[model samples]
Target: MKQKSTSPWAWVPTLYFAEGIPYVVVMTVSVIMYKRLGISNADIALYTSWLYLPWVIKFAWSPLVDILKTKRWWIVVMQLLIGAGLGGVALTIPVPDFFQYTLLFFWLLAFSSATHDIAADGFYMLDLDEHKQAYFIGIRSTFYRLAMITGQGLLIILAGFIESSTGLEPVEFSVTTQSTHTEWVVPQAKSVTTGGENQFVVTQADVVIGLNKLNKIQADSIKDWAHKQNLSNGFVIKEVQLEQAPGWWSSNVATPLKESLKERFGKEDKSAMFKGEVQGNIAAFGIRLAQMPEEGENVVLNLDRQSGAKDLSLVEGHRLTFNNQNWDQQAWVLVQADPKLDTAVSADFRGLSGNIPFAWSVTFFVLAILFVVFLIYHRFFLPRPAADKPVAESKNMLNEFVETFVSFFKKENFAIGLLFILVFRLGESQLVKLASPFLLDAREAGGLGLTTGDVGLIYGTIGIIFLTLGGIIGGYLASRNGLKYWIWWMTLAINLPNLTYVYLSYATPESMWIVACSVAVEQFGYGFGFTAYMLYLIYFSEGKSKTAHYAICSGLMALGMMIPGMISGWLQEIVGYQNFFIWVMICTIPGFLIIKFLKIDPTFGIKKQ
Candidate 1:
């Protein structure tokens, strides 16, 4: 079994590297890419996060591949499959309706990735000797880390840069400042631009509300409020051609009361009328600002009383009034007033065209990467493995896969082995896929509604580093102590701290700091507890085909994750966010059951003998 050189075990690094790429691409980067493409954050969360489906359910077909083909065949074939999927993605980039089609393509990519993981893991056992596996433990994790970094970091950075470059936020109105405001208000008045024949501005000045009398209730209240403050009559005016014009602005309705009074009251009578309040009658007409948006910028108020979030800014009976019928809607006089509108939101409120999705080149870039990967794999990689090495010691396909299980099963405890694998990651398989989506969901629906980029930085960067650290620490622990005692307690730690998210669901931490700190706490706890469990899987897979057996364990692990996540979305969707987390906490009953059933040596994680 003595290999030629120190680098004989170089394959482990590649295995882990390949493993990381597709997982990150299909699981993590897809969401990040979709988010920047102008998909609603909520919709991105709901649809894209569901992509965890391939990983979780990958186990069902894993056994078939074991029965029929060499694990090496699975790895190379699936890589070709993935390259095709990515190639398909690239080719469709500029095609009409690409978004809908791309999603299906990525889903295809996910399956290829999941299958590839199974094969690479199996190949690792066939390819490595024990000492090589030992030295290469760090190697596998390191490259896997690289894979995550490559997919989530480099690829996405490229995508973000692409979006920044070729993307269009759109000019929208593309302002024209030449139009006059005066002609708009008076209709026949000479243009504010002074010479233009085009009557570009719209004015509400001519349309009278016809109701000039105030109701007794508002009349009495206004009289009292005005008298209490010792305020005399004055009107606030505003005119707006809010939509359908470029650089369009309507100034407040200006009524020339001073000049009009000289014309109407002939100077002497003007002072008393200007100084006095309108004592005869008053009328009130009002528009209610009823729409309350749940999310986003420049949100138009949907304005239905029953639908939309409630408008908390509303005060009782906000209104407008006419003091007298002698009032001029067109001219400014002591007896007349002009129209006013305080809100100047001007994006074509009459219809649906304003919210057009910005067309971007991110999809085009993603497609390009796909083709590149396919070309590299097709042209250089797939043909190389056969010529470089000979199958000196060949076996039946099933025999190759079953080798590690047969050798280790007799000497190692099978039940104990499964226990270690299950406990090692504990709830990790359930968590990694589920947590991000849950956080990104709406508050009303029980999710934290975090933006996609934030999820990537927090979970992708922070979470991955800690998971690697935990895996390393777990390996050390199993080597030092027996994996037994460390595992039960570690499993406890992993599953228990997760309940923090359960509490976070209802606690309503208003600040981002609170949410981030809480996540870090749970994540770190997950890392600490998971260390011992991972070491046990390696410990159980210690003999001939350990690599192959370990890969099977990995596929099973992915299955565990995929199943919970498949239901996680629907569960969160149904019970809403907080309660779904509460349910996640409740599921710990089964988690505890697994820990209790599997007994490890109490000294397991302390140090290797």
Candidate 2:
């Protein structure tokens, strides 16, 4: 084998960055995809969740990858395959209707990504020398964290933008209903008949509903299903006159004047004028015809006058039948009816000019169209970052650790590799899985009641910087001292992030700033603690089939995340968000116990000898 001096620090960062990405994409965002695609929340959690199975169970097959192929071949093949999968995802993302197909596409990508990890880690061991590997440990860890950040952070932002802008069109919509009530308040006409002394009844028809009954107990029939409903039946039979005459006395004088005319004038005397006040009652309910001719079919209102009349000479009698001449304003029908029968009323008319306000419609239509156009070009058509990374030589820190990364995955240290995988990414995966329902659920639902914007800020902006710092520092410490020296310290760092959620659950702070800062601090601990685990894997995978060994480690890591995540939704569903975070804290104890097994010499990062 040809030997040349190489820098381990140079490649580790980007390599690990590459390592973390596919898992986040396949596992995490897939959950998000089904949700936005209109899948029911429960179905989104259940169906999309299956995508994690490949990673959880990938460990069993990782050995085959190690024993069979060149690390170089596996790396390139898996990378190309992932690239193809991403392209497929872009194509298939159009229809939220097909979730199963989309999830299958993602599974393909995960399979490729896991295999890539196996091959890529192996390539690292074949390439890097021990001294350089030790020095570059921090560098590798940083890049991998960046990859995770990019998957969860950047991709999510893009998806959100897409979701907010798609599928809107031009149409008109609104709601209008006529509220009606019927009441009889002492007829309001100054005792037209004696009060309660005698019950007057009229000759009825052949039990048919009559609409023209004025002297037949005059009242509005808009009340309800009763051909013989009792009077004063909760129906407010009242009228509101908008404007009144010049003087109040004019109304009273007119009533007296009417009596004088009747007394003075003979039965046949000629007098064209008659005076009276308009009684305020439920303004006659009858056919209200529009003043103008309707756009289409005709409207007709007919009156059946009393053929063998006794006396049709009452003012209320006249009001019982009305026809409006104004086409625009409808004529009101004050006809009385037996209020006991169910009256079948129909408007017998059609169009409402559903032509909404033209200017508003145009404005919204333009805004929607422009928004869709911008995002479609930005996401699928226009190129930002090519979604997936290319398989190439990396200058990241983990790149240097490639040599020792093989020994980390040897069959001899299978248990350690599994442990590191299971415990290392536990906090990150669990937190990511748990945060969604808490933020999106309503306040009454016993959550903190933050908006999507709040979640993005707390988990995204501040967490980014602190997590970067922690990862960098932890990576540096592990590289400088040794795995044993820093393993427990890093474990403490990672597990402590869970406590922030505990604090958040207990303290329902109003100030978003306070909540945001707390989340960031916790994420920082995770970043720092995660670095030691990455270094250990690299250390163990160094000797033979480094990439295959690393892939096994990565598969175990996926299992750690998948199991907790699968049940996390159920837990939140059961105990609610507040109690769930406390449970997460309880789970952290197991991780700390596992950390006790890590054996790091004091001078571990300084030299591999």
Candidate 3:
């Protein structure tokens, strides 16, 4: 039977849109999700970095798609599998072993998605003629990016909204500071009382911290102790422990490790207590739930600076989780005022309780259903072309597979090309893994301290917009002057903007607009600089088997991203965010050094009249 002709518009956009969703969810959304769920940065980076494996090795199985089945058949089956994987992720999120189970599902999603990529790209060429292919390329890319915005921006925002709304009404508090003539002293503790049903209560609604000047020796000692605790700008947090014992891990493992560290360094100086003449003021507030949460329900408290003096910073108790077992236990919030503040200043903080796991589960459930819809729509609407069939010489498939890789390695300057591919984005690979975590982490931990919703708006929506504009402008300039002329400039564009992170780590700006604009600048530079990298892949893949070779190049690119990303979190913990970003800047040096040894066609990216 003769296949009917269908407009490329009917399926191309949706096809590519489907392609982008799983990749973003796996790469970007997973990072944010893990961070929010209280996974340590080291574990989040290491585990999620491993998720890139399927993509990195997908090229190895490309020949299977060609020999065993038709591309259209592969595409439909993979979509179904992808949907099932997403559903599995949704189901596992609320379980006790959610981390392990969700990762298992995500692995299934990754492999299925990678296979889908192989099939879809192959199907695009088979379904459309050369003329239509050229015309619809931009349309496909646009829809793919729309999928990114959907996953990175809208989906995250939806989760954040659900998180904020599903729990109890938010609690608010205020802190004020005043300079007093009398010597400053710590306030005496008062017993906390339970509130009415379903109410969350705080020990104090308002706190006043006394400001005073201390002798130079006392100030210096206090500063040293605070610095040792990762407190900065003259802030310190003091925990008031309850009578009940901590968990086994905290009692046995964590406590021992902390003691060892103190032994290795020096015992904390009690004499170094707050007695500063021109030092920051400190205050504490306590929170607890009046009633126990029902079985399987957990109340999460997230405290953030709503509005006030930019100088007021929360040094501890940014996030606390409570359930039936610990609903009565009180958690303390410690705030510090900058030493330079002499006049009265005030700040307000709001504590929100939301079901984070439920919100994320709903988000994944939405993705699963969306993919099912895609599977159904494409099952009916996808065009069948004459050339969309299995390869004829199935017997030679093994030989052909081996020859494809062998020939790629035989190309001139293959070593240089491989090295260039691996080293070009070393800094970027590490930065991408930790960027969201940096924004979401607490201020005391040397991060920007933004909420999930705030991160979505700033890094996802606004950053992506600037990223697209930068790419557009970069392409135009490269087409005008060619790749060689713009290579150095592009390299600088990608690496220099990393300094924005360095500044953010040090300055810790509280203004949303400032944070958004800084992220925009960095993302734009990344997009602009990435043009050179993509063009180089195209240039190097120019050969008799260009498609196969390009797939190989892509795998190597993913490998480059994977390794650095895996170790970034561990590195950040050691050096701190400020120094870690400076290290990223230092990593850029190798990329620049490699450029000096590269051989390129001067007119490669120039457009022909």
Which is the leading candidate under lDDT?
Answer: 3
Taking all chains together, each candidate's TM-score versus the true structure is: 0.49, 0.49, 0.63
Per-residue CA lDDT of model 2 for 1-609, tens digit only, reads 543433444345545665687777777766655533334456666666676666666655665555543555555556556656665665555544456666667788878776776655666555554444544555665677677777776766554334323322111111111124334322221112333422111121111222222222243243232211211221112233358655765567744664564455313322112111111122222122223233542222212222221111111211111112222222222222222112322111111111112221232233224334322432332212221122223434354345334455345647755776776665556677877556544445555766444565666677778877877677566666766777888778878767877776677677777777777777788777777777777666544445556666666666677787875765455455666677677777877776666554455556565
TM-score pick, better of 1 and 2: 2
Q: Residues 427-497, candidate 3: write the lDDT tens digits.
A: 99999988998887666566776655567688757997888777767766776777788889999999899
Ranking by lDDT: 3, 2, 1
- Residue 469 miss distance in model 1 (angstroms): 3.6
Off by over 4 Å in 3: 1-16, 31-49, 95-97, 120-149, 163-167, 172-196, 204-283, 292-315, 323-326, 335-357, 380-393, 411-465, 474-526, 539-548, 559-609
lDDT of each: 0.48, 0.50, 0.77
lDDT of 1 by residue, 1-609 (tens): 543432433355555676677778777776765543334456666777778777666655555455554666677677777767776766664566867877888888888888787666555544543333333454576688798778866775565444334312211111111112211121232223323221112222222212133334544564454332212322222223335543322222212433443354332322233222322122111211112222332211111111111111111111111123211121211111111111111111110111222222444345446545543543433322222221224556555545534654565457755654543443455555668776655454455656544565667667667666755655444445455646666677677777768776777666767777677767766765655444545555444444445555665655555566655554444345556566666666665676666644454334233
* Best-performing candidate as measured by TM-score: 3
Considering TM-score, where higher is better, how would the candidates rank from best to worst? 3, 2, 1
Which stretch of 10 consecutive residues in model 2 shows the poorest summed lDDT?
346-355
